[model samples]
Target: MPLIYQLLLGLVLTLLIPLWPSNTLPFLHLLRSLTTTPMMDGISLAQKAQLHEVADLMLEIYKTLAAMRYIDAQAINPGPHNVSDLLYGLDPAVIYLYSILPYIDKDFATNTAFFNGGIFADFRKSDDVEQGRDPFYGSPSEENFEDEDGPYMRPWVTPLSLLGNHGSAIVYDTRQHHIWIIDQEGWSSTDPALEGVEDGEPDSINRNYFAHIANRPAGDVLRDMVRWYRELKELPGGTEYSDLCWDHWDMDLKSLFEKNGWPDNFDGDAFLVDQAREFCALRAKGDAENPLGEVKKFTDWKNGKADRAKKAQEALDAAQNLNETWKARFELWNAERSVLRNTEELKKAQQEADRLCPNGVCQRPEDLPLWELVAVQRELGWKQNDLSYHRDWAEKSKESDPEEAKTYRAAFYLAEKEVATYEKAYEAAKADADRLCPGRSPKSVAGIKDLDQDDTMRDVQRRTELDVILTRELDALREWAAQIPPEANEAKGMADNQIEGLDKSVEDNQAALKKAQDWIAEEKEKE
Candidate 1:
C-alpha cells in the first residue's frame, strides 16, 4: 500500500473506534485488567458481553460503511427485489439494518426475495424462501399462488407477502407517503404463534418465519395493490379510493393484513399494525373536525416513525464504523506479524551464511601456506584468469548480502583510501611523462590525455559506488536504531496520563450507573 493510503486509513481508524475491545494500546491494557478474573459476576458478565457485541456490531457497521462510503445515497433504492438489489441500496446506515436481519447465507435460495436490493435482500435468500414457503401452494412464486380476489386484488399479494416476511406492522406518512419497515422482531420470540396449529387448519400453524419475498417491482406492485384493495372495499374503511393511494397503502394494508387472519404476535409488530389501523381510523373520521387537527395526528405519528428511523440509522452507522476500525487494526497487526516472521527467516539465513564461511572450520595454517603459494604463482602469471577468479570470489564472499551496506562500510572507507593513493600516483606519472617527452609525438600526447580522462572517470565511478554503499549503511543503521526503547520517563509520563484519563472516565460511568440504579429502585418503591 502507498504511504498516503496507510495514513488515510490510520486517520479513519482513529476517528472511528469502539469503547470496548479496542486495539489502541492504552485501552487494550485497561480491558485486560477488567477481565483478569477467571469468572465474573453474572450480571457483569452479561453487561460486558453486551458491550462487546455492541462494539463488534458497531465495528461491523463501520466496515460496511467504509466499504460503501462511495455510494450515491439518492441513487440507492431497494424494493420487492432480491439480495443483490438490497445490497445496491445499502448506504452506510443501511449496513446496520443488515446486522439485525435474519438471513445472510447467499446459497439459501429461499431468501432471494426482498422488497429492495438492500438489507431486506438478505432476508429474501433461498433459505428464507424455503422457511417462509406458502403452505397454501406447493410453489411460493406469485405466479403460482392464485390470487383469490381476482386481477384487481393482485396488488394485495405483495403487501400480504411483506406481512409474512417482515411481519405485519408498517407505517406510511400522509404527506410524502414515507414508508417505515417496522421491526416486529421481539414480538416473534414471545408471540402466540409459537403455539401449534389445530388439526386440518394449516393456515393457523405457528410459524416463526420472517422473510423478504421477491415479487414484481415495488412501485408497480404497491400501486396496483392499493388500487385493488381500495376497490375491494367500496370505501377504504369509509374513505374514498382517491384517498387510499400510495399514502394510504400503509394504513389500508395494515388493516387488510389484520382482517386476513394475520397472527397477532402481541409484539411491536402487532402494536404498530394496531397503530396503523388507529391512524387510518382517525383519517376516516373525516375533515369536518379540523384540518390542522388531522395534520397534528399525522405529524405525531410521523415524528415517532422518524425518531425510530433515526435511531435505526444511528445504530447502523455506529456498527459500520466499529467494524471498519477493527478490520484495519487487524490488517495492520497481521502485517506486523508477517514482518516478524520475515525477520526470523532473515536471521536463519544469516546463521546459514555464517556456517558456510566459518573462519577455522575447514582451512588450517598449512592450507594458508598453500594459498600463499598459489597467489605467488598467480603474480608470476602461471594463470592470470585463475588469479583474477580467486580475487573476484574473495571480493564477492565479502560483499554478498543485503546487509553488506552495514557490514562493508569500513571496507568502503579502505577502498576510498586506495582510490586516493592510485589517483595521486597516476597524477605524478602523467606529470613526469609530460615533462619527459613534451610534443614528442601526437599519438603519445593524445594517449596521455586519454589516460587523464580515463583516470578521472574511474575515480568518479569508484567514488559514486562508495557513496552509494555508505548511504545504504546509513539507512540500515537508522532503521535498526528506531527499534530502541523510548526513555523510561517519557514512556512513564504517557502511561500515567492514559491511566489517569481511563480512571476518571470509569469513575464517571460508575457514578452515573449507580444514580440510574438508585432512581430505578426509588421509582419501584413509589409504585
Candidate 2:
C-alpha cells in the first residue's frame, strides 16, 4: 500500500498511529509536568494496535461506500501519491495547498460491482514499514543473540527513520484535534517486519504515532476506532453479506500469506470476524493477564517543588481557556471527515453553507429553511426512537452485561439530551414558520418532498410505528408458542394465552392504522 490508499481512506493521518495504554506510559505524566501548550490543530495521537483496528475498519467502510457508489456513479479516477514527503518534510502543513491524486480520467464496470479496473489494487494490505523505526530491531521471528533473551517486544518507538520509503505520515487536518494512524501503507502485514526499542515494552504492536514527544493515552483513540468500525461495518448488509469483510482484498492477503510462508488457504473473508470470534473464545476460556501485573497508576518520579508548582499553575491556567478551542457539538467531524472523499461535494457543501450560514453559525429560526427544519425534524424522530431503543437496551442488558448496560444508559441519556435539543430547534422552527410564513402547514411548504401529504399524517407515522411494534410482538408470541412442547401443558397454555392476546393487539393496531390512513386521505382530499 502507498499514500493513495490512505487518501482514499480520507484520513491518512490516522491510518498509522503510535499507541500508549491509558494508565501505563510515562508520556502523559511527563507532558503534565513540562508542556502547558495544547496539541497543535489536527494533531493527536494513536498506537500501532489501534492503527491495525482502524485499518481493518476503514478498509471495510471503503468497501461498503464503493459498493454504494457503484450502483449510481461511474466516475472514480484515483491516482498514486507519495504523501510521506509532505508529512515528514520541512513544512508539514503545506499539503492542503494542492490536490494529491490529480487524476482526470474515469472508468466504468460491467456488472463486476466496483471493479473500475486497477484502482482497487493499492487498498489490498496495511502495514507501517520503513517509517517509525531506527536501526531496524530485526523481525519478530528472528532468533536473539547472546545479549538477548527472546524475541523483543516491537513497540512503536519515538526515534524513527524519517526518510524511510513510502510508509505512513502524520498529516494535517482542516479542523479538530485527535490522534489517528494515517497513511499506514505496506503489504504482507500478514506478519510483516517488527522493530523494538530499549525503552519500549516487548509486544507485537505494529505502529505508534507522534511518540517522539506527544503524551496522550492511545486508549481513547483505540475506542473511537472501534466505534467507527462498528458503525460502518453495520452499514452494509454486513456479515450476512460476508464477502464485504475482505473488501476484495482476499487475493492480496492470500499472496501475502503465501509469501510469508503461512498456511496455503488464507481466507480474507473472515479476516476481521475470525479475530473477533477467536478473541472472545480465548477471553471466555481465560484472559491473557500480565504475569508481572499491569500499570494502574502513573508516578511523577521527578516531583520536584518547581514541577508540582508548574502542574498546579497549568491546571489553574487551563480553567481560563475552557471551551475556547473546541466543543462537543462540533466533535466527531474528524471521524466523519475520514469518509468524506469527494472534494467537489465537500466544496459545494462548504460554499453553500457559507452562503446560507456563515462560519457554521445560523440564527436558528430565521436562518433555518423549512425543508432543512423538516429534515431536522425527521432526524429527530429517528433520534427519539434511538432514545427509546437505548433505554430498552439499558434495562434489558443489565442481566447480561452490567458494564454494557451502563454504556446503554449513557447513550440513552445522550439521546434524551439530543432529542431535547432538537425539540427546542423544532419549536423555534415552527415559531419561525408561524411568524414569517403565516397560515402555512408543512404541506404548504413548496418543493419539500420529505414531508407527508399533510401534518395530520404525523398520526400515520405514529400509527405505523404502533403497527410495527404490534406485528413484531405477534410474530414473537407465535414463534414462542410454536416452541413450547405439547407435554409441557402449563407452559404451552401460557404461550397460547399470550399469543391470543398478541393476536388481539395486531387486530386493534391494524384497525388504528387503517383509521390513520383514512384520516390522512380525508385531510388531503379536503385540502
Candidate 3:
C-alpha cells in the first residue's frame, strides 16, 4: 500500500564522514546508555564519568606542566595545589581538570590530544572555582554567556557572531586524539528532540549538531586515551620522557593524588574483565594478536552496509515491478468481470466461487510473511508514536486540566488499541515466516524459495505471478533488519534483556560476540 518500497528504501547512504560501524555503534550505544542518561539514580554523572575516564592517563601531566609554567614565571599557587579535606575528596588531577574546563580563550592549548601545557601555567590555585550550570543557560544580562565572571573573565565570550564556536570545535578532535572528551551535559543533551530518545539509538543525538553527528562515545574516547597511555608507558625509550613528566608533576600534581583522595578507577572486577577478553577478544586497540574488536565490527559493518543497501534497492525494484504486474492483471480481471456482469453467467459463477470460499479468496503471497511484516511494522511504529504522544499529553495535563487529561487519556488508549493490533499483525507475520535456517530470526528470513507451499485450492480465484518475485526481492529487506553477522544472533538473543539497561552481564556477552566475529573474519581473510 502507498509506495511501501519508499518506506522500505531508507536514508541508508553513508555520510561522507564516518559514524560508528553498525556493530561498534551498538556497543557505543550500550556505553552511553549506562553513563549518560540524565537523572539516573545510583549511576555516575556523565560529566564526572567522562572527566575521570581520561583523568588517569593525563591529569598529572597537565597539572605538572601548568605548575612549571607558572613557577617559571614566578606566579603563586600556579596550579591545582590542594583542596582541603573538609571540602571534597577528589584527586588533584580531577580537581585540576574540572577547575580549568571553562577556559575558552582563543589562545587555549591546541595540542594534538588537547593536552594543556601553556595556558594553565599562568592560572593560580586561587583562581579555581566551581562552574555550576549558569554558563550554559545564560541570563539576559549575558554575564554567564560571555563567561565574564566564571573564568575570572579571562576569556571573553563575546564576538556575538561566533557563539559556542570555540567550545564546539574541540568536541570531536579531542576524542580522535584520545584526550579530552568534551561533556554533553551543557550541549546536545538539552535538545528537545533528544528527549525520550531510545538509549539504544543515538540517531538524533547532535553533540556537534551544527556540523555533524559526533558519533564517537565519550567512554571509548577515554578508553582510547587509556590505551595510548598504556602504550606510552611500555614503548621503548619512553622511560626518559616519563621521567621528565614525573619530575614536573612530582612537586604538586602527583603529590595531590597521594596526599588527598581520588575516585577508585581500578579495573579490579576480575570476572567482568576476564569476561570481556573472552567474549570480544577485548584487548586494547592494536594488540598483536587481537586488535580492537570495535574496529573490527565497524569495518565489517561498513563494508557490508552498501551491499545491504543494494539488496534493499533490489527489493524496491521487485516490489514496483510486482505492482506493475498486479496492475496489468487487475485491469484484465476488471474487464473480464465487467463483461461477465453483463450476462447471467456472472451471478452463477460468483455464487459457485462464493460457495467454494466464503469471502473472495486468493492465494496469500509467498512473500506475505516478510512483506506483510514490513507493512505491519510500519503501522505499528506510527501507532506506537501516537500512543506515546497521547500518553505524554495525558500525564502532563492530568493535574492541571482533568477534562483535557481524560480526553487525551481516551485518545492514548485508542492509539494503544491500534498499536496492539499492528503489533499482533507483526508477530503473526513473523511467526509464519518459515525460518531461513535454524536459529535465524524471522527478520533474517530472506528471499529463499519455498516450492512446497499450497497454492491450488484455498484462495483459488486468483494468484499473481508477482508473488514469487516479491519473495525473492524481500530477502534484501530481511537482511536490512538483521545486518549483524549470523554468529552474533546468539549473543544478541542473550543480550536482549541485559542490553535494555546497564546490566553488566550483556556487556560481556556483546564483547564475546564481537570477539567471535573478529576471529571468524580474521580466519576467513587468511583463507
lDDT of 1 by residue, 1-527 (tens): 34465456555545444444545756544344334423222224223433333334323332222122111122223332334433432232222333333332222111222221112223344432332233122233233223332121111111112333333322221122222332344322111222332223223122322222111222333343334333432112212211232134444544544454433222323332333333323332321123334334444554554455555445445554444433333333333433443454455544543443344132232233222222222222322333354445446766565344433443343333333433343344345435654544313211112322333344545455555544544444344334324443443343345445545555554555556556656767999
Candidate 2 at 376: error in angstroms? 1.7
Listed in order, each prediction's TM-score against the native is 0.15, 0.25, 0.17
Task: Report the lDDT tens digits of candidate 2 across residue range 422-512.
Answer: 6665665566657776665545532243444444576678678777766865675576457445555654555567678878888987887
Q: Rank the candidates by lDDT, best first.
A: 2, 3, 1
Q: Which one wins on lDDT?
A: 2
**Residue 52 accuracy (lDDT) in model 3:** 41
lDDT of 2: 0.38
- Model 3, 1-527: lDDT tens per residue? 12243233222222311475666764454344433333222223444344444333234433433332211111112222333431333333334343433222212221111221112222123222322212222322333323332221112111101112223112222212222222234333322223443334333222222123233444454344334333332111111222221233222323322222312332222322222222111111112112223334444554455455455445445554444433333333323433432333334444544543234332123433444444444445666888899899999999999988977876775566556555655555556554522344324433221223222322221223233333433443234324334444443343343234433433544455456556656767999
Q: Where does candidate 2 stray beyond 4 Å? A: 1-182, 185-368, 450-527
Q: Assess candidate 1 and give its TM-score to the true structure.
A: 0.15
> TM-score-based ranking, best first?
2, 3, 1
Question: Model 1 Cα displacement at 339 (Å)?
Answer: 23
Alpha carbon deviation, residue 49, candidate 1 (Å) = 59
The TM-score of predicted model 3 comes to: 0.17
lDDT of 2 at 56: 38
TM-score of candidate 2 on Cα atoms, chains taken together: 0.25
- Scored against the true structure, residue 477 in model 2 reaches a CA lDDT of 51
